[model samples]
Target: MPDSPRLHRAKAGRFVTFQFMPSLNQLLAAHAPLLVLDAASTRIQVGWLAPGSAHWAASFAEAGIGLFECLDQLQTRPEAAGAFVFCDGPGSILGVRTVAMMLRAWLVLRSRPVFAYHSLLLLAHARRDPALTVIADARRDSWHCAAIGAPLRRVPTAELPVRLAMPEGFRTWSTAPADLERIPYSLAELLPATHDADIFRAIDEPDAFLHEEPSYATWSPQIHRAP
Candidate 1:
């Protein structure tokens, strides 16, 4: 199949490239016995979708131990998974990175295909509301926003529109807007509704989503000079 369109976002005064995410339906059609991990919120969610199965076997737990607990519940070994799916975040950085680290280690043991989706994008597609804007905290009073048929972007909290939705369990540093909708983040609830939905993209390396690749200036020693 031909690849999807590339997405880009401005980071560090330059736009960074993003791979096109395929829809859940497309993923199901392409791979079987897929293992999915989502740790973008306070609760960690794991899902198992095997060949010819209509429903996903799901589990949820608190962040620190959730991934392992879900795997244990599904009785899945790394080798048993045909391919892996993960939610790369605009949410919990530590939790998302932890899952990414584990996926990297497993890939080293046995090479397999890996795919990823943005947390806000997934929620946006699931909600299927053109007018509703989905957001996650981006710190420093900014928020990551995703609307139907639009690329993800970071907007100032003050600039957010009236129809705003935040997924359950996301942490926020800024005060939430009035009449904000708390959308469900439970995979157990989402998968059944969106199993056939087209909204995932392929990824080679698993890691947390960064609007831009981090850049640092080299430090040099110099004698102090008075202005």
Candidate 2:
């Protein structure tokens, strides 16, 4: 990206590989890269963390943030050597185009490698024997859902029903979106601010399916009883 600090690639650079079916863990040896955002129909989440720090810096707002912002903000704000972004799909013809433009923009703005992965796949990547069904309500009287078993297939959010609930076999894990609402970082504090900030905000998307939130961060085996 444009504001990047120059550094040569690590000669011994390698990525940690983990098996997703049963659990997810990175190789302790892998350096942490800045994880940009999870733009979804329900909520927009942003975060970054220092490699191996185990601590997280995060924020949350409305969904569709990707459709508006230049995306270089993710690179510029945190100033990471590399960036990874996860987004729901298959978006409109315009959404797909946005992804393409954003990737190129990040490359130029950050002067580093920028990668885009399907948000569902990234989420599913952490699941062992992951069965992901991209569901979203089309409104009207009809809705759509696409169930997938990863390593088996990839599903897009637009094609799925927005309000559709997940199956029983799956577990949930998300940094509380509400927690992000509490950290009041102003737009002026965003380093390089944007005038067209509406896209990254929330939307009135599909909400046709039925699902429940499973306990993620707050639950513990010792203190919480399983239903």
lDDT of 1 at 164: 96
Candidate 2 Cα outliers beyond 4 Å, as residue runs = 1-9, 12-31, 54-78, 88-103, 122-132, 137-227
Question: Candidate 1: where are CA atoms >4 Å away?
Answer: 1-20, 52-64, 223-227
Model 1: residue 146 alpha-carbon error in angstroms: 0.5
TM-scores of all models?
0.83, 0.39
lDDT of 2 by residue, 163-200 (tens): 23332212224221121112122212221222111112
lDDT of 2 at 130: 29
Instruction: Identify the leading candidate in terms of lDDT.
Output: 1
How far out, in Å, is residue 8 in model 2?
Answer: 14
Each model's total of backbone clashes: 8, 22
